[model samples]
Target chain A: MIKIETCLTPEILHLHQLEGKIAVVTDVLRATSCMVAGLNAGVKSVIPVKKVEEALTYAAKGYVTAGERGGVKVEEFTIGNSPYEHMEEAYHGKSICMTTTNGTVAIDAARKSADQVVIGALLNVSSIGRYIKEQQKDVIIICAGWKGNPSLEDTLFAGALVDQLKEEVEITDDATYMALSQYQSAKNNLSEVIQNHASHAKRLSGLKAQNDLAFCATEDYCDVLPILNGDEITIK
Target chain B: MIKIETCLTPEILHLHQLEGKIAVVTDVLRATSCMVAGLNAGVKSVIPVKKVEEALTYAAKGYVTAGERGGVKVEEFTIGNSPYEHMEEAYHGKSICMTTTNGTVAIDAARKSADQVVIGALLNVSSIGRYIKEQQKDVIIICAGWKGNPSLEDTLFAGALVDQLKEEVEITDDATYMALSQYQSAKNNLSEVIQNHASHAKRLSGLKAQNDLAFCATEDYCDVLPILNGDEITIK
Candidate 1:
């Protein structure tokens, strides 16, 4: 009985028994998308740190630091959370320290229980889906929602992944069905569907993130699977 | 701002600062629907107890005790958790002691912080919508999901209510948007939509609850808004 469950937000991660399961952490608005883009763009590795100061420590060294606090560039950091920024050739063969409000927090939490934690986003949906199918393990897709609330982008992304894997595993919970249904409904018109109503989309657009939003919504744009090893994310 | 939010499951109730807000508890499958039906049938009051022993205490006092623990009638209880069973004139002007797996537990939790807590369900969607609009206060819709995980039925009901009330309030979080989108997509064929994926619906149907499922899914079937004053559920 292969069980597939979803943590709609990081706040409920504690309630799930994730030990020995493959945890796919998705912060689709940009965290996982950015990290997956970094690996796909040929970055050496991405170190996920929970604190801004921790990212600063690696920046003080010759390693580049890239992160956002409230969807904007952190002070003194060389890069912000745009996938477009990470796709540049200059990032190739260089490791970067990264942090974000929701993504890294979820990655750190999933790290404690999951035997394997990987970054997931629309950018690498197929890659992550393929990887999970190959592993043949029970999977838990954790959506790194805004703070403690769910984000439509993440849930939609989870539904996309579920759509890919549903025939292979039993979706044991209704939350997963909810996501799959939402995704099925929104899959046809990703941008217009999500942008019209998503709270995070509204917040990001208010901060002028139209370019990033469009970039993140394009499904399977990258073939990178940013697998988590200890505290660092590297392409598998 | 008259903010509107939703707890997709009872486990996330602590994440929302529900203080000074009107909490609307929804367990669409049976509990809230049954309570709303009891109120509509002219029951004097329905006390929500969190435990079987607590309900038994009320039963000792000659009060009608009705509830379900694992989707079946409790032993020695006169009636089960079906709305149809409670629509009898025998229950009129009677205060029944009610307990269920998820609904009352949620109502008990909401009572601790919410300025006012009321039961909301498909049976009383219009009535609850009217009540919330009249209160003109911030609202939190609590979906009493199956156990601690999110349930499709409760979330769909929340989405239906969000669709009703979104224009009048500021939806402060993404969970609310998720629900609203779901409702928008599923509203046309709610019974078909929800029955397709809801885990609780499948479980109940397996236990010969087809009638109860159909009864609970009907929109505006009952007109009573069962308001929770402390622990007891009574109409306003």
Candidate 2:
């Protein structure tokens, strides 16, 4: 059995070892959630850019532009980083070029470790779980914590994944158990579960992200799986 | 109010900033806890040397030499880094020359933050707490996490201190609150609380040091405050 662990702090993530593993990158606030939403709305692929200029170049190429900066949607874009924004019909059958505050960085990190990378959120748990089971290799559930720091939501999703795949994987660290313990506690409702965490509270105070917490918290929302395929992401 | 924060990761720890603050160097698995137990048991002061030759040079001055290699105490030393061994009445009033795995590295890092530096553990929580409070400055609760990694015990102590002084300070990240929340969940009974952590279990597996965990967990057991007074550390 492969070791499934939660890295609360992003610096602790062993970025080099993600190769040949199916990496489930989670940024619960908006990145992975929005990626999941975009994929669900029939977006063919999502390119994550760390900088807005990079996103703009993709936008100028006629790719659908989407992202969030300072918690607000970037202007003149087809969509923002909010998963709620991905629900519109305009997002369907499009290739989305996105940049986000933290999620893309996490995806960037995962792209190295994983032979195939998938975006996992409460919005796409069941599909991600099934995808991992099918891969049959070590699965590193990478939680993209906020701003290179361990945020509650990412670790909570790590725990949620652990709760789903416990008997199959060997767990590592108090971080994993602590996260799973939290996931179990908050499984009924993530809103009450993450009330005290600073990042969640900050996101709650921002624009278009209130229900994002509850939205990201609800498990198995869609059965679709997002797989990163050679510079393009595909949903199956 | 001082920004008293527990930086859990080692690399994330601003090593160069150790120049100014009063640093409480701690490595609970044995280093700091052993230091505290030795001092409290009446050992005058332990002169910490980074190298064995330096410790041997101090050992030439009629000091009880103590240290560890590969988790085992060295045979050349009269004492080892076990808090229980240092707790004997025979230890009281005797000055020791010692070294260890990680605490000294932290002390070295802490020597950069500011002027005053001190040692902290469950044994002397209140003493260290009140000392930091009395200092009336930005208190950096540096947890000598294992090898610049996120250690469970060290972060737990950081959380404990945060819980003790949260109302008196401003905590910055979700890590601070998350640790405090975990400590709160486990405060009334630390053993049960600690049992959930992996490091505690691993440390308890073989070494006679298992009892030291309980001893260190007992709040306010030691009134002796170990502080770095210069190139050398002493009790304040």
Candidate 3:
């Protein structure tokens, strides 16, 4: 049986054995969701940088810079960390150099540790699940929680992915079981549950990004599976 | 309104701002439950040491040495981590120097970061709730997860404590909400849920410690509030 586990936050990612595992790194409050939506909407590739300065360096090389620090667009970047921003038709066929507080850090970390790293979000959960089953490898869902702590939206995405692959995978760890259970509890009213309970959702709402919250909660909306190829994330 | 948060594992304890907060550290499958049960059964101050060698050092001073590593009793220690062993009248009035894989490490970490650190478990969850309510301080439920990973039983205990104080405190963080929701799901048949889902329970059961699991699941059986005072845990 293939073992399925979850690292609830990037802070605890070190505790998980990532070698020989397919790492599904998710940041549902935007990062991974935006990547999935962007790739599906025709963005060529996404280069996730850990810092705004790195993204700015990519911008000089003709890559569109997208960044957000605390749910707000970085003043130096052309766009922010939002699915809608990335989904714009004007950005079609272009490469994106993105940086965020949590998501990019998680992606960078997972890339170094796991044999295979894929971006996951509610928007592309089913696609990620299908990819994992085909690979038939041990799975680790890494939640890019808010600034080194656990976040509800990312965890819910982890749970949703677990729910998608529960029958095909062995859920032996507590974090995976907890994530599956939490997803079961919120699956019926995911959007409402997230908007009401997630601290990141409230932060986004305060920044007038409620639509982004609602959009990111939509499951299986994008078929594009963003997988890390060297340093850049591209459609698998 | 006081905010309540959860540090799901000791690995992420540094992310939590524990200053002036009441830190309730729990390891329900054993450790903290054993401490609560031992104290309630009339054992004098329980000293939680991080290493088995430290526990053995205390043994020379007439303190009962109890230790467990990976759910088995240490060869050098007198007893393993079990609430049943701790409840024995033979140990009454004797101080215990205890060490375990996960629980003691968590307790030691919490005591240093938080203004006050208290042992928490299903056995004495109600007492912890009452104490927190009276203190009226912001609370951080530190789950002594199985070796730097989150554990189902400890998270459930955190949830039970959250349920107890939900009306009095503001539940702000996702981990706290997740714990409270998880506890609500299992509260109806907590023992069964734990026995089936908790990894630590299975680990203990392998060592013929199933009775310890059932005993630790018994809520409100002990009113003893184990608080850290200068490296020693005593009744408050």
Candidate 4:
């Protein structure tokens, strides 16, 4: 049976038994969207590093560093976390060493034991859902929440993906049901739902990151399925 | 400021910084309902024990032991998990020892460090909301899910409670907002929303615990505020 469950935040990822499951990690506000956009725009690969220093190490080794902390660009990084930056022609055919406040940490955690770890966001949720359905593996969605707490965008993304695959799979737990219900309720007015209701959206508004929010909220905007290879992600 | 947030399950309890907050824990499927029902029925107090052995010890001390695991009554306990059982005159004016798979563990976890921990259920949500507003404390709703996962019934109850208090309280996080939105959307047909959607409801149906689910799903059926005093719950 195709059983689907969701880890609402990476904080609770350790509690989930992901031994034989496919883990789709989402940090939809920016990080995962950036990675998806990068890979779709023909970047060689996206290397997710947990620490800013590690991103810097990759920069020294000729990869471009794209880092953000607390919604601001890292001091020494070549690019900030804007998805538009990755969509630029100069970024094409280059490797990116990326680090974000939440997504990289979740990726590192999921890397330890999940049979397969794939990056997901609104940009590529449809593609990722189809991929999971094709694999026929039990699914676990790990939401890369803001600093270990749930953010609405990631959970809604999980719900949206569940909506895509629910006809072909069984929801394994109540959280998955809640996510699917949430998506069902909010899918029609998603932009309004996230912009006015999500804490991260409100937070990003204060930081004048409206462009990033607009881009991240767009559904099926990219078709790349960025799967983890060792510590880096490449489009499969 | 009266701030409201939710820990969707005890598995995510540590992520919530609950040092000075009023922790309102809910296991809406039955445990909190039983505690609230017992207190409202004039029981002296309800002691929530974490282990079956602990409950058995309380039984040896002339206390009535009420325990459940996997949606059924403990083999050694007198009563199953029905709130109706706790409302009996036999339980009146006496201390009842209680343990359940999920609720007791969450209570024990919150009891260790929270400034104040209270039990909540649909039976007394209005009373609990008014009580929290009166206390003027920042509130955290802990959902005692099956094992360490999020359950729909508890989250919906949390959402219902947030719907009650959002006018006076500032939601401190996105999860709170999400819960409130969920409640707003589901409150119109709460019975349908919970009975049709919650995994626990389906599980209980399989176990023939339909009566418990029906009882637990009712709203504002009692007016007890089951506050934890030391380790036991006493109505306030």
- Least accurate stretch of 10 residues (summed lDDT) in model 2 chain B? B14-23
- Off-target runs (Cα >4 Å) in candidate 4 are A206-208, B206-208
Query: Clashes in model 3: which pairs?
Result: none
Candidate 3 or 1, higher DockQ:
3
For candidate 3, the lDDT comes to 0.88
TM-score for chain B of all predictions: 0.97, 0.89, 0.97, 0.96
From the highest DockQ down, the ranking of the candidates is 3, 1, 4, 2
Q: lDDT by residue for model 4 over A185-207, one digit each (tens)?
A: 89998888888888888777644
lDDT of 1 by residue, A1-236 (tens): 56899989888787789998999999988888889888888889999999999998898898889989998899888899998888788999999899999999999999998989988999889998899888899999999998887889999999999999988989988889889989998898987766777788887764448888888898999788888887779988
Give TM-score, chain B, model 3: 0.97
Binned by DockQ into CAPRI classes (incorrect, acceptable, medium, high), candidate 1 is medium
User: Total clashing residue pairs per candidate?
Assistant: 0, 22, 0, 0
TM-score of chain A of 4: 0.97
TM-score of chain A as modeled in candidate 3: 0.97
Which is the winner by DockQ between candidate 2 and candidate 3? 3
TM-score of chain A of 1: 0.97
Model 4 over residues B1-236: C-alpha lDDT tens digits?
79888888888777788899999999988899988888898889989989999999888888898979988899999897888898899889999999999999999999988999999999899999899888999899998988887888898899999988878998878878878778888888887878888888887765347767777888899888888998778988
lDDT of 4: 0.88
Clash list (residue pairs), candidate 4: none
Q: CA shift at A111, candidate 3, in angstroms?
A: 0.8
Specify the highest-DockQ model's number.
3
RMSD of each: 2.1, 3.1, 1.3, 1.8
